[model samples]
Target: MTPSYGVRERTAPAYGARWSRERVETAALRVLRWLTVAFFLVVTLVPFYYMVLLSFRSIQALLLAPGRLWPSLGELTASTYVDVLRSMDEGGQGFLLFMRNSAVLAVLTVIATLLVSIPGAYAVSRLRFSGRRQVHFLFLAVYLFPSIVLAIPLFVLLSLLGLRGSIYPLVVVYISQTVPVSIYMLRNYFETVPRSVEEAAAVDGASRLGVVWRVSIPLAMPAITATALYVFMIAWNEFLFALLFLTEDPANWTVSLGLARLSGSIEIPATVLMAGSVILTLPIVVLFFLAERMLTEGLTSGAEKG
Candidate 1:
């Protein structure tokens, strides 16, 4: 009987033998990962979907069915977009002007920041000048200061220079804010470029500038594009500076400033506010999608190798 019991015990498999501890853990983690992804996707997309839905909905329909997630086709219209985009003189919110101002500031900031940062980053990376290591520390220190600390001084300086309420001064401020970060980013990318490539070009009678332009610039285009997009978004959405400088003149308002004004006012409709939000957000979304590959490469640059 004891021998028979021993035989029965040996013949029966151990409990949970097929599903080992590691296997159970792995399965749990896989399910948890998918659940986390789905939660975040819902969190991110639902608001934006509601926003787009509200933007298309009429005020009457919105008030009638405030909780409705889906608006009827008949209730949807582009009038909200029209209202947001049309000029104040045309009895609308005048986002078109705001868009233009934001565009100008963002474009100029991108250009100026890139122009300065590229050379600065290259010098910091490739050259052996005195205080070379300290330069990056200075850039980091400048960026670490709260932007609010710079705002009042900038406002006063712009006043003295008679540049307040002008997009040009806003561009200058953005350039100051963006250049250090741009240089930091570009420097990382530039450092990744092999010296052999530059030396080859230089040996072939190309100047130092030619070697950089022909070799480094092309190689760093992904990073440059990412930096430009970063600067553009900063300039486009900046509120404190825009408020400090441009609040006196509605004509000079960037989209962010205008949207802020709208949000603060009781008279503006929620639908219109949603429309303005879409207007402010849509360009960045479109631009990001268009350059998704380049941006991914740029962000991941040097992450593994460096």
Candidate 2:
């Protein structure tokens, strides 16, 4: 009554085939996921690492070994940072001046853009204004238009008015470029706020402006903060206008323009320029991470409500 050997062998082969297919599929998915994540990490992180790595070495090291990923401790140098930050009269790049100018211009642009865009967005969202639909179309059109195109007129006007090489005109230009998109972003977030809360505030004798300031502003703080961060980053990283407007006056040069101009010089080492770049990039990175948490929390809270 013993079973035949072929019978047992046939069943064993089928079972093994099933198990093999399952193992292969699982392994393929795991590999795909890891590959995707690795690609993202490399793309996002490699540039920052390179900036830091290059910043710590001299141009001789970089030129002699352009392919090196990490600098040896013996090659490490902090003199690049000092050389970049010190004043030109002291035989340095004078980037500290550019940093101050950029900070002033970016902060002023953020303040001006937020002041105008906040009210405009609220009006468009809450009021029964005529042409409300066309307003959004106009904002979208303005955003889509090339900054280079606007640069031509702005450049000409600033030159004619003796405002070229000054920070004032650059601030104006930054405000124009940022305000439209800020309005659009703030408008979407405003629309998401419950109308009932505003109505309740109105019942308590709050005026339209009061409702916006007292109720809407507090409720929409996260979105407002996110939009401010967005505008701040835009102003901070702006390069073309900064170059065109401020290149003639080293006193007015932004960090971006200064870095570009300094990097172009044959006498300046690439590592020193890289150090300047890291100095320029660090603030924006810190701000983005801080604001990212607030943005996600705001968006997730809205999503949960629905």
Q: In model 1, how many backbone clashes occur?
A: 0
lDDT (C-alpha) at residue 105 in model 2: 92
> Clashing pairs in model 2?
none
Displacement of the residue 18 alpha carbon in candidate 1, Å: 9.9
lDDT of 1 by residue, 179-285 (tens): 88788778888888899989999999999899889998999887888889877877787888899998878999999999998898888788987999999999988
Backbone atom clashes (below 3 Å) for every candidate: 0, 0
Stretches of model 1 off by over 4 angstroms after superposition: 1-19, 300-306
Q: Worst lDDT window (10 residues) for model 1?
A: 1-10
Name the runs in model 2 displaced over 4 angstroms.
Answer: 1-23, 295-306
RMSD of 1: 6.7
